[model samples]
Target: MATPRTRGAARAAAALAAGVLAVSLTACGGDDDGGDEDKSGGTGGTGTTVTLPRLDGESLEVAAVWTGTEQANFKKVLAEFEKRTGAKVTFVPAQDPIINFLGSKIAGGAPPDVAMLPQPGAIKQAVERNWAKPLGAGAQAELAKNYSPGWQDIGKVDGKQYGVYYKAANKSLIWYNTQVFENAGAAEPKTWDELLTTARTVYDSGVTPFSVGGADGWTLTDWFENVYLSQAGPEKYDQLAKHEIKWTDPSVKEALTTLAEIWGKKDYVAGGASGALQTEFPASVTQTFTGGDQPKAGMVYEGDFVQVNIGETKAKVGTDAKVFPFPAVGDAPPVVSGGDAAVILRDSEAAQALATFLASPDAARVQAKLGGYLSPNKSVPDSAYPNEVQREMAKALIDAGDDFRFDMSDQAPQAFGGTPGKGEWKALQDFLKNPEDVAGTQAKLEADAAAAYGN
Candidate 1:
């Protein structure tokens, strides 16, 4: 799913109207000597420390939207930072439309030192408004050494770096119950035709083939995006993302019609369309993983975030629950990804130090070992991941380089791509309810998109 973020000056003005104030960190610089450390790849030991110059004990406020398992894992990373630099790191959760909170803070002149943003659009807005400080030379060098040029580009606004992409989630994956597939004698699909055939095989074995999460509209968007990228290719994907062509363009219809092939067969989806419409994304994963039911689905398609939901179920990843790249609909599988970007809001030696740490392999290793987090840093080894599948997924995404794209919805404004109850979500929900009405769905998509882009 594309993580949602807000934009526009009107939104900033509205946030300031609400009188929400952001509290800044009070810890000042100290003379403590954090051992002189290098900015290269290392495990930060007595001989090799992860330290930034002149930032030994300054307090820094960091912000992001991570919660639950993600939050817990990040704390481990922060703990490592505290050990390395002796700087106090406080995590402040950015509320919905972080633009609002950021706007209020900027207007009040109390922004955090570093804000970990989730949207490229927000990064662009922050850079344009001069609310973000570009990554320091140390941080940029780390990024240049550890991350691919594509990952680095997401942080750039007009070819100048304003942020560092730390964590990435590959969205082009379909998680399935190994037992269910094995019992049905259905191997993992390699192509769209193979996937349809596998769906039929699973359906024939007295089970629904897919746990469609129609209620959580972003899941639906991911479904459409994976197919769109594979069928229409990445160039058109880029064009569609920028709204250079209308959403009513034939590429969208081709994707939807392909979706209808499986969706029109109501029996293939657990609880049919109505149940799917009521099912949330987490529940969809649970339904697929928790089998031995009357009408349970076999697979749930989503990003690695679903792994957190899977932790709540009885299934184990790699052993019981397995995933494959969404079977290619065209020449090759689509490698869709999404992640958080760390941007400096307060220009300071301490803030720049923190940015340098976040951009390094040392910081990424802390979270990678805990699972559900994939770092774009190439220096982080594959063995650091929790499972081979996840390791391969992250490696494939990194290796995909120029071939990969951020979630399309994330690239668009929230109203057009990321909103829950309106825009693409609602329009796609309508299509799920009636898959055969491709033209009608296309019309709504164009109208909402046009309104969203003001085209």
Candidate 2:
């Protein structure tokens, strides 16, 4: 299960370390130099020099959906921000489709100063609603020094900067149980057909081939996005992401049909369709690695962050558990990615200062050092990653530069892509329950997308 690393554009990687991208957050106008430059904020792990403005009595609130270990690790980063600027920042736990949560908070006039938007659509929504404030010049300078053009573009809407993507995830890997594969004599698959063959082999060896987290609709979106991107190519993927093409396109049907080749086989999934619908994301991952050779499932597909859950099991990565790129459906494997962007919801001197801090390598490095985190900032040194796997994964993302695709569903409007129990989430959940209805599924998708996109 040793996945071959795709060599990124060397020229692109070189350019990544050279450019300065734009960010928008107003500096709080605090100009008290705290001793030496290094003490206040010299290199601070970020290769570029960043001098943060002091905010002695400034207090700000930041909101995101991160919980558990993810929340704890992020808190450490906030602590560093506090130490450097003397700003008291509180972490607010918001629910998924954070726009909905923020809508109520904004209406209540108690919105956090900043929010981490999980999708481009949500960021766009924030801007459309006039809830998001553009970043200031100081924040833009740090972004230019630390981020590449592609990363910077993700946060820009209507030709204006609105967010800084601090955390990134590679969503095209499939982690599997080494013992199960070894026992089944199954080789890692490189193409879609080969994947089916491998699944059959594993099933004949008395174990399920896949562990699907159907309960969490976002997982289903990831499944379709990877398949659609690889099968239909990036052009159509982008068209669908922007809703420029209907979801009922022949291309969509083709991808769904191909997906059904696996979903149609109940024997291939850990708990069958019904059971999978009841399985949450965490359990789907734990099931693959918990029982050794006789685990409930042989493989689980997710982003690089899957390593965090693997840490909870008796299995060890690189040995008991290993990964491969999602099998190719077209000429090459799909390189789809997702991330969280820091957006200013209520502009303030403290709010803007924090945005600038996040854009700096100094902030990214703190989270990168902790296991299960990846940063898109090129200035983050390879040594920041805790292991070789993470370093390779992070390099792949930075190296890909502008050639890779962002998550498909994340690009669509929130009503069609991100909401829980409604829109695309529920539509796909229904599809997962009855994958046989490709036409019906496509129709539902098209209808929902039309409403969301106002087509």
Candidate 3:
């Protein structure tokens, strides 16, 4: 799950790992004068006793699938929120397999007040099963104006809003070692032909051109989606998501062909890199730059969040590691992958207040301070960004407008996120395992989609 960012500039690294780690309260700079009363009704004002209700009187239970470093960041945000609202947040961090745990809980009728889902499909499924509620009128209006149009659309299952996005990173970029490109006398590519030439040049320089990890069964799908964008453009991609078009379309076939061409290049990727199938997504990304000290691979195609995962690596941002938008293949429009919204579940006073605050430009600034994330609020100024890279990325996002889209896998039905699902990841894995059966694989996907839509 790589979040999308604006292109053309490097952003300051905000430690988002802790933000996604778990839900807990972190102390913030605020007075704890319980006896100090404010006289401005429920609102805090001088001489009035303003006491905000805590999130959970005894314990606020929150469930999420963000583990490892990401879970840690999530706890930090919760901790800060609890301090501000005097709530006790109990965090339940789970593995990537969140659906199973959540399914049982929803069935048991003991659902958490707030659940942080990585994919939009999970939220949709929850809504379908009545395990979740829509943000309703107020939340919808406020969030609609705060986030990007694409982010807002992700939370919509049918025509109702059910989620709000808090933290997001963009994925339509390629990360390369700046020094490697400079040493190889190669420039950042702006077109598919240029990219291929650059990759070939790098490969001929006695280094693995790309450090992609296809072993995980999903990493290779990144290439597929980007290729599709290059071939069919963003408009067709959207139709595909809504089941308006079949997966066996010529655009899809061309994308797959392009991927096969890249993968066909021997030594283009690290030897034994396919072993990454056994490794997790984060670990596989780390493997790309892990051996750069010995120059195993020079570049990797991933989202901006990879910067947060590759800790202790000598790859410094803008120096050792830099990102560029995936070059256009033919006449296709640019498409990037970003996270969905983080919907508010509880309509408590605190939840309402928090929601209102988050919808404000001020709150967007606060979020940037907490973790240099792209704010959906259009009102926030680019100068407010802490780092040059972030500022540039934010600018790109604003300019991208309707061209940006959510990750197809995340936008698809929940079943698509699973192993047996009909998604780009599963499709790529099947294609790679049996290249000769590409058409059969595409046919199976089309059949599944048709069945799901009852067409």
Candidate 4:
């Protein structure tokens, strides 16, 4: 379906196009120097620019949950930082699970100089426990002025900034095959009822309407968060985030009921409940676009990162797949989930330099060039995006305004959070197995969350 681009997306596109034109002109003209002059190391009294100090003689280590494609992109940025500054970054890429590695390190009192925490709960915990240092007023002001409002708030703990944000992966998007929707004579649904009707119409046409994977447990949590915000609004969501509301609240129940109803539909989701339970997130995401059908599934509700996994297949972004905001249900504003903020441990000079560089628009442009994500920086143009899908996602993010919230699973405490082998993950798996027991499922979750929060 040809969903009309929202005003925010249109504005972002215009900004991006203008930025791209300027960049092209500058590139052609060989204007190599363009950055914050005050911040950029320029000529000094000694007729030599003061370079960022090397980490070779410095005692500092960095740890993070970055691996695979993300690691490569991170390394590329870090390498540039190291060269610009004389710092030797000893990056310990932990493929051996993030929490386990960091838990041990933090306990030993020898934590790394920087840690790229993908989970908001981990970032919050780190701040609460005094495991990291605040970025201070100066850094916070720079970030607020440079990045998106959503990103600026992500790093705030007790109204103080604790991290410097860089890349963001928007999750409140629904990706669909454009051709399939067009052929089905379907338009992107604007309201929850419209969405359901559209899904039913698409399903009645013999194609699966949605491809959701609940088997990973984390995926189910996504549904919960989406519905919660849609039903209760962002204010209530914020209350939930701050532990002011109970998980067993009526609003939470209503959201769970909506998920159960959606999941209960025959062929509403590909592979059924069993399929959703056993499949990994990426595999589940790929299921929506698999095979030679003109358009396999109508939509796949997932994060912006889904484009990265889909890129490995025969379908290319934009042509084969495009994204729209997960339509608002009732009076709720459109919301999207994603991760934000990159935290520096404050001990290493190199790490601080790296953080400063990343907070700049230059680093944001670099992230866009690498693909598979969007920068939280509003000033960075989307024209730097390599593909149309990335461009679309970036535009959606900028348009989301204050309605954008991080994934609930990531926002909760570690115990309630769906980390591997956690109770939250286990409960989701159990709930999916028996979709009839909605109350039982919620009770289990409420108990778990209360225990975790000491409520």
Best by lDDT: 2
Q: What's the CA RMSD of model 2 in angstroms?
A: 8.4
Q: Where is model 2 poorest over a 10-residue stretch in terms of lDDT?
A: 20-29
lDDT of 2 by residue, 23-98 (tens): 0011111121112132223344333346787899889999999987789889999998998889899999999889
Candidate 1 stretches with Cα past 4 Å from truth are 1-50, 53-57, 95-97, 104-110, 292-295
Q: By lDDT, rank the candidates, best first.
A: 2, 1, 4, 3
Q: For every model in order, what is the number of clashing pairs?
A: 0, 8, 41, 8
Each model's lDDT comes to 0.75, 0.81, 0.59, 0.64
lDDT of 3 by residue, 65-133 (tens): 666665675576566567666777777875444566777776787766667676777787778767666
lDDT by residue (35-151, candidate 4, tens digit) is 323222222211112234455554446676665676676776676666666566677775323556777887897777888776777777878777777774445556767776657
Candidate 3 regions off by >4 Å?
Answer: 1-58, 136-138, 148-150, 344-367, 370-372, 379-384, 417-424, 434-436, 451-454
Q: Show where candidate 2 strays beyond 4 Å.
A: 1-48
Local error of candidate 1 at residue 395 (angstroms):
2.7
Q: Which candidate has the highest TM-score of all?
A: 2
Q: Is candidate 1 or candidate 2 better by TM-score?
A: 2
Relative to the unseen true structure, what is the C-alpha lDDT of residue 382 in candidate 3, on a scale of 0 to 100?
61
Deviating ranges (above 4 Å) for candidate 4? 1-61, 95-97, 108-110, 136-141, 148-150, 294-298, 399-403
